[model samples]
Target chain A: MCIAPVDEMRKNHMTMLLHQRDKTVQQGIRGQPASLTGCIDCHVTPDASGTVARSDDEGFFCTSCHRAASVKIDCFECHADRPAEMISQLDWKSLNPINHSSLLAINQQSFPYALQFRLETRSMALNQ
Target chain B: MNKIDQYRRKFLGAASAAFVGITIAPGILLQAGNAATAGQGVSDAQRWGLLIDTNRCEPGCDACVQACNKENGLRSIHGPKTDAQWIRKVSLKNRKNGHVLNMPVMCQHCAKAPCVDVCPTGASFKRADGIVLVDKHTCIGCRYCMMACPYKARSFVHEKLTDQLPHAPRGKGTVESCTLCVHKIDRGDNTTACVQACPHGAMMFGDLNDPDSAISKQIKSLGSQQLRKKLDLDTGVRYQGIPV
Candidate 1:
């Protein structure tokens, strides 16, 4: 029927209106800063030497906004509650099997080879 | 006579001041002198221990295993059984003595934990209270922890994690093991699955900090021994499988 053409035109107009509305909404949504990455974005502190910034295991930096955003934080479920500075001071990495075994002599004496390894790394940096 | 009296009064005042100083100084000295005293008075003492009694333990109880799974958010998979158990009730027989012992085998939570040292990501570390645990977020799934564990306490998850706790979700490719129910311990509940599940009261859980605690008293009375003492892991869990 002749009414079918008018209906089609009307449908086309509605689609165009919807498309325009969608375009406007999309445009409004654009150009805004993205959502918070959390944890990954923060907790990274420059080393005492200030040459590099690294993340502590607990993600305290990321937690700054987590509390603000009302996100339940549970880093301590696996990580320690103490600050990374204290953990680093304990020479914890030296206790690892690969590192600690190297510290022991054939006679099983606790030698200082692990300390030497770190000194060697620092020397390598100094040499550079 | 007045000058002499004035000098005598001044001398008496000085003597009184000296007497007061002598008395007060020693009291203050005694109070401050014991600052470096040893034993319980020392604030920084760390006494780590573990207790495993075969008598009270169930032979094949998986309560500790399953409890650890839920507490740590370990998901069991169908394919290869990755990300399953952090603690398992292992039945062991001494070849020499021909004696069987039921032990809940998990992270020994060693004082000198091997997994902690081998981690390049610093994911594994011992807490101040001496509980060894893995920080899953930092765990790179390098399998170094699995290799480092002499007791075979750790396992790796191959499958991606779903249905995880919002607080502590299981991450893929990370190593996990029994945390000694640390989350519960932190929440003021001392019971881990193995300890709570052992209907016979085989496993004893308590803060080693308290000398009066049952675990501390049990170790003292029973003279518990650590597994692989030759390794010098300084394990917190002690085994009293044999008669003292």
Candidate 2:
């Protein structure tokens, strides 16, 4: 399932990602729903060939749309294009969904109004 | 510089520098409350810090350093000179007695970090909670922050890095350093990887902003020292038992 409808995501993902990147990088907010990592986790998967597609590949999730629009993105240059599980062989605690931290928090005043519907107070992201 | 002059210069700074202590929050002395969930930005009210008891740090123990590399997925085919070492065991030996002391050193996470000042693109920054990080998106690989750092903490990625862990995103040409295990911190796992992996319990990680924090109380009771204290960096990392 998508976080938002296909049309809505296609239209405004860049802006949502922009907000998420700044918050995560500068403000140390990782619980936000629009994180690029979150998107890659669900979207960038292996096909029947059992090969995971990189951003440069035409069959890649982000690349297919971006290539169609002729919009070049540099996000994959520094960020991991693969899912967390695919990147590291080590069984890091962070990669385990069972051990993943709660992600319900996102109620800062600076957050976008449209996205605030799903936002909850900081208390919602209590450490489990 | 000659040996004597170098010795004099080093001592000159050490002479003026004193022990680092907890001077904030007169009497509150209460442990900081739990952090808000993942959705929230790290609170400025909590300044993360590490306290290392060098007296307890054992020689030849690389647990903390190994843990750091594993946690950050930092692998290197090259030797020490080119390899990324976010945390390394620093051995200090007394000239006369040949006594050896050991401690782990990484980014000090300074309150007034010089790396933040020298970055032309503002990529080098201190998080409001006191974790120093290089925002690779804004970093142009200029390496000015690397030079400005007094701790020699930051390292530049020379070759194309493939398959970096999501928890620690690194790339070619950008400068990076110790993040104090920000990924874990943001997830509300309060301890750093180095501190977690230390077998001797030589390291402590906590919120320095909280007067009652274990680290703050330790700094209060035992006293700690910041390396190169003459610079007055107000480093987040502190050490105990540096033979001054």
Q: Which candidate is the best by lDDT?
A: 2
lDDT of candidate 1 over B1-244, digit per residue (tens)? 7999999999999999999989896345333321121211112133434577876676545565555544454544543233345655555444445556566656788888898899998788665557777766567888888887877677676765433443344556778777776545544465675677666777788767788988989877877877666678888888887422
Off by over 4 Å in 2: A90-128, B1-38
Determine which window of 10 residues in candidate 2 chain B has minimal summed lDDT: B25-34
RMSD of each: 22.8, 17.3
The global C-alpha lDDT for each of the candidates, from Candidate 1 onward, is 0.53, 0.76
Query: If you superpose only chain B onto the true chain B, what TM-score does each candidate give?
Result: 0.74, 0.84
lDDT (0-100) at residue B67 of candidate 1? 51
Give the true-structure RMSD of model 1: 22.8
Extract clashing residue pairs from model 1.
A43-A61, A96-B117, A96-B118, B49-B236, B50-B236, B50-B237, B50-B238, B51-B238, B64-B194
